[model samples]
Target: MRYLLPGRAAWAVSLTRTIVALVTLFSVATQLAALSVQPSTATFSLDTTTLTIPQVDYESAIYYRDGDPYPHLDFERVDRRRTVRKDHTAVVMENRYVKLTLLPEMGRVYSFVYKPTGHETLWQNDLVTVGGAANDTGWWLWIGGVEYTLPGDEHGTTWAMPWSWEIIENSSRRKAVRMRVREPGTGLEESIEIAIVSGRAFFEARICITNPTDGMVEYAHWVNPQWTPGGQNELTDRTEFIIPTDRILIDERWQENLGPSPQAWQGNPLRFIRGWSRMGDVMADGLTGGFYSAYSHDADEGIVRVFDPDKTPGVDVWTYGYHPTQIPMGSGGPNAGYVEMWGGTSRTYPDERWPLAPDASLQWTEWMYPYQRTQGLTFANEDAAINFQVTPEARRVVIGLCPSGEWRGAVELWRESVHDAADGRAPLRRWEVTADPATPFIKVVILEGLMASEFNDLRLRVGSDQDGWTIVEAEN
Candidate 1:
């Protein structure tokens, strides 16, 4: 088994126009191929950032606009509504008598989806932010979906904010989900892919962040995956979270919002029980279950759940279902909690928490799995079931980050002790994460060879849990 790192080529911003030319050329070539096969739209709308396919198609299932305002692809009715929340924005459009709404902040969809190929809508309410803020809003990155419905999860914002989406159908059967963005200021393009085949979904999403300018650029990205209506409660249970031993950040505001919390509670700022949640103490009181978490599940409807090692830990994982516990807030909203990729959100924390990568490009990985339920399987046994084997020849990366100042590492996730997707039990704790990194180098855990169905979606959640984590920064 080879643990060799994979091939990666990067150019700093100092390479100047030469690098730009090369990147532009490469980007152009890729864009051209994307454009070449993209289906022509009858009408396009700038107001909603939409391209509608009027049940008519000619080219492949790809659509290309190059971050530029889409010119054509005729659609009627462009509407915008400003909510009471200043930071909230909504764009609505309709075509083929179908209405679509785009809520920029909400984490994801949680309703029903109409699919000729049998597609279902997941959660309807959206996450405001991992840290929960209606203050400064980030850009809304929507992957490709042609049709979006305003009504699904029936959330409060489901009416005001509404659900927004895009679609792409190629003659080729391969499905892809990701509408990547190249930050207008710094042309660092980050993207992801999601698809549904044979009634199941798979994902491969990422940010190919390039610092094209002369100076170093810092940025952070979140892996957002919407779970089904039952709530990810089932998934949150029976889960294990793994990460580098670093100080974790959390949301303090959530607690103040919750007011008088339970006496039984011991606050771990980095924990999912942000100060804001009684965590359904009235109902599940002594247990970790929330009404929402209780409703979510990770089991297959009837058949056995499968496992794959390479793509997911097979057995070991970072989360079961995304629970309020994963975030400090009793509510599992956007502001709940997440991770900080790269050097973007680190310094916001206290202490010597400077950029871990500084001027270097460090790489890290996180994976998810939906395998067969083997309650008491050993690592070796579970490893094989997941087809995950990290060998010497397998591509590997030795990423280093600065671990100065306030740093912490946490593995918080939710799970269902009861396999019922609707059992509505809060996630059960399955593992204890005590950091004991001997040489400042935590073992890079990789679950390899994961098949598409073995996991639902590939979501690498990025946000400062509370403040941020400090790695052994990349050294010269």
Candidate 2:
């Protein structure tokens, strides 16, 4: 298997597993049938490659405007309390692990509920208003949750508008609900396909945007997920975001408001955690695997958003200064007091642009996984959910996992010796345990002869009968 390294193209890590001693394969069935009509539900497929989720559709009356007043998407009236019934429709897809609510009107996730935690992963607005203050986008709307924008600037036109949708339960056990929309004035067609892996607490969003015009077009693609750490109705000071990046830049507009010496806070920005500091937005660039997470140690659970940096290379943290200013009318509302975890184009500023040729298309994938752990998450994706803390001085390492549904095998931990920065080290201290989604995978090791800093890599190798060996590494 090929592994993509940070800043560069590729890196190699070899994992070994004995096939005969530790192999477990799920038996595949020959057929599967839906149990209901409107809300379709089913279990594993005949091929045992996928799992079908029950889907239901309903109507929601939302408030929105037709014009772009600012650079992003926002409603026209912030004070209006009017809602038209049947204005738009919503869909719900559910499995045993998670329940996802989506708005076909804008191709955004209305709510993401993790069954184990019984918490909504995305912060939702009680009232879907139409307008708000300006940002990189024109007039911004504080609808809450995860929304997809493309081919234009912040919060594209399609977010508050309607889109076409279809739900399919493929034979391989994979079920997907696809939503598509064509920009009214532009020659861009955007679509988002969402799917869940059977019994796993995660969902994947595959986004595609195409340009059909004869001339070149420059646009931005952003997958914005408004998260309230602890998945509560209100944002609390206890909520903190964990992002892995090589560099971070404070928003220029915010720096100007700081009245000089903005770099002082560069070392530790958490000093502005009062929930009213209005500390401007921060952009984390040059991420290793395009993974960003937010967790509350008090709640012991949080959401992780991972994407392909090659397409969506920017990870933005948008804060409404500490007053919940992003949603003026939403003050004291469900959508009030939130921060945005945005994965989008490499262009961090509003002025940056990426040009696309005629008929060219861009494709990308995003994974939103909810996990239970308060410590700190080093890495996460569809393959595995890991939380690890290493006290180099203490010579102690603690790790946990929410492994993939297919990972019903074993997890073995190893410590590699440090030689040089470029050389991959040798493995030591083998600690193995059974991998099960029904239970948390945790392992702590006190090094025998090597200090935590001396080790080049702390790796976890997952041995499975179906896919062979999968390796997940922690920061050295």
Candidate 3:
């Protein structure tokens, strides 16, 4: 064995692992003291004498995004055995998923598609007292106070699925999130809000759903963070997609909702992609821990989300999936999360979007720690040897599909790739990780898609350089 330090640090405790699971645990303890605030348990994360999260609502808090200004899933049942845990950063109001929305059926007097005029539903619930609402239905969201109002869909339950209150205190430059019942008959609402904060990198995630009145609804949701630099968030061309390694059961109509039906012309009654591909096997990581993913916009944008069982908890990690290029606003609502059957493109479950189960919630964890890639795997440069011991079989992800085609580039890579979707073309270069001095990548390789294009022969390109224009004869 190579020479190295021995023994583990005292305060660092990783719940399940320990033979000596030896590294110094970075203390989250200074972050452990519970916070207290006004009205609700929520409090401002700032260390001030007073504790209250600044309120953000639909009306007063919307618009103006980009750069430094803005700031800003899951499934299954089986009553067998379940565990629910909430890990918070001791700061108040930073109460990640602690809030819930209690919507009522009689509320939406002005549902977008259902009304003759574009007006917001008139909410008259004893549970909710409306304050200053938006001017138009398109402006249904109300800002200022920490409360939002939503009338019921044609068939949705009044029960809430988190994200119902005003984000009293948050870092997004964009205002409050608004709930629209895309489908009238369901009891679901897609939680939609955009966070526009520049600088600082951390894995920030939120869930959106179109309420469904149909039986048990099952749909997937993904965290869309454009990765960036020191922040280790997502950057423009940086991408990555992680998935699980097991059989996947998806709605048959999902593909029809996005584009053309590969089997529709043949009388397949419009089909869905129903089975798992070998692609899942190639991207499987034994040390993935089935949770949050770490990324940088520049380093990311190249990665893809992984979907399958080996991925555990059966969650899909598709990134820049669907809209490779950003979609123009106003044309259609943010086509991000899922809603009811009428709401989501894929008509999964009983034509509705439903939560996991009564007491069972699907949770995910992503390690946003900056990584140095080697042989298709991303590892923290400062702790490569330690990471190796803890994650002996962690494989950098590659080979998967999304809105665009499957990704086939490197992680934290500085190289370039190109493609053209106009012509049904595939990438020509194989996944490669190299050190481009002009680039900041330590070493990277394509982790989501397979490259099979020839110079100038591939139809598209990704990353900052010319796609298919170059090749890595050898691995770094």
- Among the numbered candidates, top TM-score falls to 2
TM-scores, one per candidate? 0.31, 0.74, 0.27
lDDT of 2 by residue, 1-476 (tens): 00111111110111221111112101100101121122223333211113221111111222335573222321222223223222235555566666666666668776676665667677655433334222333344555678887555556656645678877654355667789987655667888898876666678888888988998877777777888767665566666677776556666566653333223322355423353265456666567776887776667676788777778877777765554433432212223366677787754844466988998998888888877752556777666667656656667777777654535555556655222324654345444555534455776777767765664466666555466665666653
Question: Taking the tens digit of each residue's C-alpha lDDT, what string does model 1 give over 1-476?
Answer: 00111110111112343333334334422422232133232222212232121111211222336654212221111111100111234333222111223333332321222111112223221211111111112112112111111111111111122223344432234333333333443333333232322212122122233344556554433222333312231223322221222223322432343333332322223223222233211111221110011111233110111212122111101111234433321112222222111111122211112222323432323221122222211121101111111223332212211111112343211221222324655421222223111111122333244433322222111113464421111101
Query: What are the lDDT scores of the predictions, listed in order?
Result: 0.23, 0.57, 0.22
Measure candidate 1: CA RMSD: 22.2
Query: Local error of candidate 2 at 374, Å?
Result: 6.1
Whole-model alpha-carbon lDDT for candidate 3:
0.22
Kindly provide the TM-score of model 2 when superposed on the true structure, using C-alpha atoms.
Answer: 0.74
Write model 3 residue lDDT over 198-221, tens digit each, in one string.
121111223345434535544433
